[model samples]
Target chain A: MTTVGEALSALCTPALVVDVDKVKRNAQMMIERCQKLGVQLRPHMKTHKTLECADIMTGGSRRCIVVSTLAEACFYADHGFDDILYAYSLPFDKVERCAALSERLDLFQVLLDHPQALEQLKKRPLRDGRRWHTEGVELTGIYAHCGNTYNCRGVEQIQAVAQETTSFTLQFMEKLKAAGITCKSSIGSTPSCSHPVKDMAQLSEVHPGNYTFYDVQQSVIGSCSLEDVAVRVLTRVIGHCPHRNQLLIDCGWTGLSLDGAGKLPTGYAMIEGHPNLKLLSMTQEHGRVEPISGPLDYSKYPLGSLLTLIPYHSCATAMMHPVYHVHSGGRLLGKWTPTRGW
Target chain B: MTTVGEALSALCTPALVVDVDKVKRNAQMMIERCQKLGVQLRPHMKTHKTLECADIMTGGSRRCIVVSTLAEACFYADHGFDDILYAYSLPFDKVERCAALSERLDLFQVLLDHPQALEQLKKRPLRDGRRWHTEGVELTGIYAHCGNTYNCRGVEQIQAVAQETTSFTLQFMEKLKAAGITCKSSIGSTPSCSHPVKDMAQLSEVHPGNYTFYDVQQSVIGSCSLEDVAVRVLTRVIGHCPHRNQLLIDCGWTGLSLDGAGKLPTGYAMIEGHPNLKLLSMTQEHGRVEPISGPLDYSKYPLGSLLTLIPYHSCATAMMHPVYHVHSGGRLLGKWTPTRGW
Candidate 1:
């Protein structure tokens, strides 16, 4: 119900606010990066599943994209998006739904890491003469996630992991060629894709999702700088717990998730522009905030005062919200409702 | 969109299933207990925000309920439920919404723990002849939540905390009476209310929420037994990581929350009927589960085999799902959609 052109302060507390400008810049940068590498940028929609954000991530083509869940695949497919890649190992129970999407769309690709899953797809064949990846039970592409790159600390470490993943994938491709089986290859992860190695250019595609709205975790891993983070949980000071030396904010574990516990000097999330403060703990609907050092100057954070929290993991934090308040330059533009469930 | 009367195996994996029979039993038990204690039970709806669950918890009276957020208060009020008590320290930003509810409903109560919050209410006068409580800026009730009872390990410890909280609340009530400012007094928490002291009857009312869907955390804290828990996350084994001696489940942090980390011997959640398996870690859509003390027995758990997970914290886990599949005797009944956001 927040009106367009209204300031962020007009919205309620514990609200997820997205910087549209940052989103566009991040998406544009990733698109340009993938274009330069000559690899398709199949941006993952798990971070922000809204159609508006998906449109931005795909640069309005909505042709090639990656989704972590079948729910996202259906959501996008229903909205004219095609050539979708459901990047998770296919769940057996959802094969029927996936088959329907495959028949309806121009192309719907599913991943399988096991022979049993391949059998599930074979049982549910696509109608109208459509085949599963050009032929029945034919291999489409080798998708490898450089998830280990999340442990890297800097650009050098990120590139090293990316290089290692690309080399292994290329070597596997060579083995497939030796066996007279040729197929495409892809490797992805936000960190690896953000600092992609030269060898990654030899791959078929790159699927990185979190780069669209990079968070503190991404910044720490050198995927993007702190300024590149596009989302913030807007909360307000609701109570001043002087006895406990903690200020209770309206944001809690329900608003901001418990994803980054004990991982930051600022517990849970970083208090934007307030390094001395730490989010001590959270209940269902209340967060305890206190200073890292000296006594808190309560006058500075009076009742109803605004505080911005830069979440540690944007994907986890985004999942907690039903709608994202899209804003540009601190003014609300509209609300983006993300589709939920599997 | 799962059909009724279908077996649970027919539904998708990672879906939250609610045992309606257990839910009714739990609600009936709490009602009988409160009736025997000669105290009014104002059930908290923060744990399960669905109208159906609220109807069950309130015994269909649709009155005398406590909500953790204004959104729930509005949702219940819009559905013809009244006599709602927003059981949190009043946030200054929500005063207008509180005022609207106060004017709309026959009785809508707001709580404030600070003088500044009181001033916020004073600034916004309710419409018509309605007064804030008895008069303008009047104290309605003194509410206290004994959240510390969560650390208790047995019924004796729970009773001790209940007795202590009741004694403290009664003492505070006496002080208010001495100052000629008598009003209602209430104290609550699942652990404290589950094992109430005789002194709790002296209070005006009691509010307990989580007993409706008792979780592993509540059972561990002596609030309820493991058998009394009514909710389970139905996931499936999608991958077998033989190299790591692990099985990847479709349920992840997105399906089951990370609330009970390091609190249980079984890691995040307890695998029902399988004490040896541990949910070690989770990504966005993949949970790495392995045996607690030995290699995973993948033979017993093939691809797509259903695994029931007893959540450590039902409230945290329930918040992650958009819909709750209500069932009885392993047969699906219907789906319960919950209202989200502040």
Candidate 2:
């Protein structure tokens, strides 16, 4: 059992502490879910941007992986991985550079929702040694990508897009096949992953990263339950103003994020297991918690007691602190420090 | 002059390119403005998170600096800097850590809004005799915090609490005064920063972060103007689907975040300089732009042309890309990469 003193001094403050057992379980569970559905796992690396996290994928062939940025691509590629997909849309200016990057690797796949996007991307592949300038080539189409409808639109839109993305991928694949080109096609988005795979049979892979650490967005979208979220920031009750009915906290824009990207505008986060108490707001170094769930139980949760919270958005919250203090078997074990700097 | 090709190629595509000149101008301009109003400059490091950026402040002193993270505090402290104010609202659990960290440096100030937060922080200021916490026993109460109306019931509610914070700080200062204590008290936030100063004017300092990079939220609250926005993302059109009148581009979730924090339902971003073009939605890799203004002159502004746009939340957008490509004198200079990830 962790005493109050031990909990306070066990790790650095304002640092990300993760439950290793939970993280492992989350990874295993996602892999098993995909396996049962017969969907290939090409998880996105943007969630856990660390080599150590990449090495802990319960079980999967190293045939394919998805990335949001080219920096992530270069990171995984340098580790001797071959098949990679740059799932982000690219500007025409970077088309030639992407083609050059594709040539250096064994397999590289690009995703584009618009015909013109595909045209520019297809105009130059890695087949030839010389890098062709798409700038000199005549341009025709417009690229409007809207596969993820999580923010403005809700879960229903996400599901439709998943279905639409699969059919759209098929159409694009048909054109590529007609041109005698062979490439790996993929389907993704944390929200869309929960939908039934309509064309999973046609797709070569499925790359969804946040499924391992589902948030309020994923939970509301019917991806997973609140308990399934693996990542959380363990914080404390620092200042209690009975007058304002608000308690002060150490978690702020830096410890968590100033982002209110949840079903509700929860300014900060919720202390797990204590649903009523919402972290109402924050400044640079402080957090305000309102007793929304029930009465303020200062007995179980005194000023010095520790409370853990699952952030609303994993990507945004994860960017708040540096190292992840992981726990397994209810004891502090290892640590996972993510790569920093843009 | 940088041709479009040269500008895109010379700079790293996914880097946070900051034209040093623009940054210098931006920083210098803000400092001059604050000085004219007699407001002490405690520039928020959440924007740049770079030591070099901090080193170039208009004020030559080191004591008056504001930060968003503890890592930043440690960085500046290690660099022989002192009198740092963690503008983030921290909880009681982290207060001890901040106190402990204060030992290595000269003085570390923190923001407080709630009584419970301060209560929690006060209880755990020092843990062991063998190890001393950074926050000296001096209780150097440079209490720079804000209790604004948006979060508060009204000015009257926080006005009392603001007085409480000032008094709490004064009480702490009074104890020091008895033992010969000398400390600086400060207050900051956009809302109250504009209102007439009351008892808070006694604070030795005042600072605000987003006042520099104002967005629609600031404009709504009447903090800054739409023209005061210093940064925007430059994207291009890649496809044109005749059936839907839908336009697609490479700037999607990876380009723009899925966050519509303080924006209309148009999407995460709008077409800058082309208000008529509404950003209907966004996917992981595409942004669906439609013409709210008449049809584009396809001949002059075809699918391959570049368009500049602003972000709903500059903080998130700054974290998404690695480089901030600075354009100056019609020339694209070097890049400024912000510190990202916790």
Candidate 3:
């Protein structure tokens, strides 16, 4: 944590501080891409869920937004982000609470690719028989999210699930139309979003949260590149053993999520700002910094100096901290705090 | 996330849920272990940092503590835990902040292992003949944490580190002795604690946090076993796809800390109760569950059902959630929030 001042001076030690300027650059770049693609930008708040950030990301209007957890939805909704897509398919048991939240807002949506959820929804007693009574009072339709990938293959998997999604949508519209349900459907994944075979006319809208920060996983699907990672975990060297050619650093399992990009290095995180440095492996509290070139930058990576680390997967990396230390250049800026859990 | 009532109610997912009864049992077990070992138990609040749990663990004394970050030290200090060990070695530049925190507390200790840290302490204002003047009064003598683990091989490693630790302790104490300097030296790690050579009489106390919650890593190091693992992350199966021989579950990277036991499976967490169930792999938002045996009890892992997952490393696992859903068996128990951040 950095110490506070008139312009709070940054603290030493390679901590998980974010550069606010980098976030702005990242956000603005995404906004531009969304504009070019003609897609509505509902940036995933799971990355940096701070109010000051939400204001900047939303550009003032409580526009369409994406959230991974119900707590996030409640947070933005309470602060007035009405058009919400609970991007992750939360369990059916949470429907009642989700319904209660929906009644307070103007627009709330969900994502689902499983048939069991629809079955659970139809059977659940969410209506009082007048205006849809759940818990106690009368509300309306439950917020829905549609999943685009499930045991998905190159093409066949999505075609099968899209067919399921299409049929499910028809069935849902039929049920909601007859019973006067007020639910909306939005379907997408990074794969479907990048190479969309289906049209917008097939669905109400689309939710592509990862499109903003494509990772090695997205690159394998031919989406982005190694240079496009918007965020990285900053760390420092702690122990160096030359005989083994391994340098132990503070960034380890806790610093970087043990997520792998299929067929790539198991150590998903790479050391940025340095060309030769690569993270070969990690333990709970220590990361093994392996250099491609033999014994490079021993001085720069001295036991106390900081090093920037970009993770294999972004969302999970984002979730590992309580707040993002927003920054730009070498200056200290603001912060962002994401909501966790259902 | 389980509801306050549901978490407290009857069955917990797989197992990390510590019922208040189990919490008491676990806390008491450690306290008793410490008593038998003839050692003072300065519990690492990192496991379960709830004040309620702290109260139970301490019984009633302003006991010494081992914290990972400065924020944690300040947090517990404000809550009446005056004696603390900031168990992380910070960069040379952050020495001032540690000193500032130490000045505020009755006794605040920071970890130091490398020569760089020794140089950092040596190059303080004392070397410049300019005493640190912070927040009005001139403060002095904040204890230092000397971490040395190379000696776990035998008493030689302990003795070597003790030699180094004693020198550092003597130097720090000599510099600030006029200001009433008193140092608290903790010369131990889980491995060393499991096999202590000599009781480094020079060292004042011992700190072996992971010893209390023996994990698979510790077990490999001959510390503890599966039964000794008292905490686990509970999750439920949401989707199953046999074609890939992979089953998708709601628990993802955020729910589980992508930390995996080596060679066992590159992905997935350890399934405690059901030995056959294995976490094959995972994505940012999904975990692939598989059965190590043929035709397993798929009932316990059905959609909406729960399973507790033992962690690869206990410290990393504990940070994934804000609260612990405690349980005792057929009874929903209580909730406890942990202390987070530096």
Q: Which prediction has the highest lDDT against the true structure?
A: 1
Q: Could you tell me the lDDT of residue A107 within candidate 2? A: 76
Question: lDDT score, residue A153, model 2?
Answer: 49
A1-342: candidate 2 lDDT, tens digit per residue: 133323424554555766666666767876776777777777777776666666665354555677666666777777766677776555566677578668878776555554576677767755666443233343222212233536424556676777777788788878877867655566666766655455755676677787666676667666677777777777666666767877766666666765554456444566777767888876545677887655676665666566676787777677555567666554676667765432
Q: Per-residue lDDT of A113-181 in model 3, one digit per residue for the tens?
A: 566665555554433332223223222333333344533545555555655665676577778778655
Clashing pairs counted in every model: 0, 66, 26
Interface RMSD of 2: 4.9
- lDDT for B43 in candidate 3 is 63
Instruction: Give the candidate number with the greatest TM-score.
Output: 1
C-alpha RMSD of each candidate structure in angstroms: 1.1, 6.6, 7.0
User: Where does model 1 exceed 4 Å of error?
Assistant: A134-137, B134-137
Q: What DockQ does each candidate score versus the true complex, computed on alpha carbons?
A: 0.91, 0.26, 0.38
Model 3: how far residue B101 lies from native, Å: 1.9
TM-score of the B chain in each candidate versus the native B chain: 0.98, 0.70, 0.71
Docking class of 3: acceptable
* Interface RMSD score of each model: 0.7, 4.9, 3.2
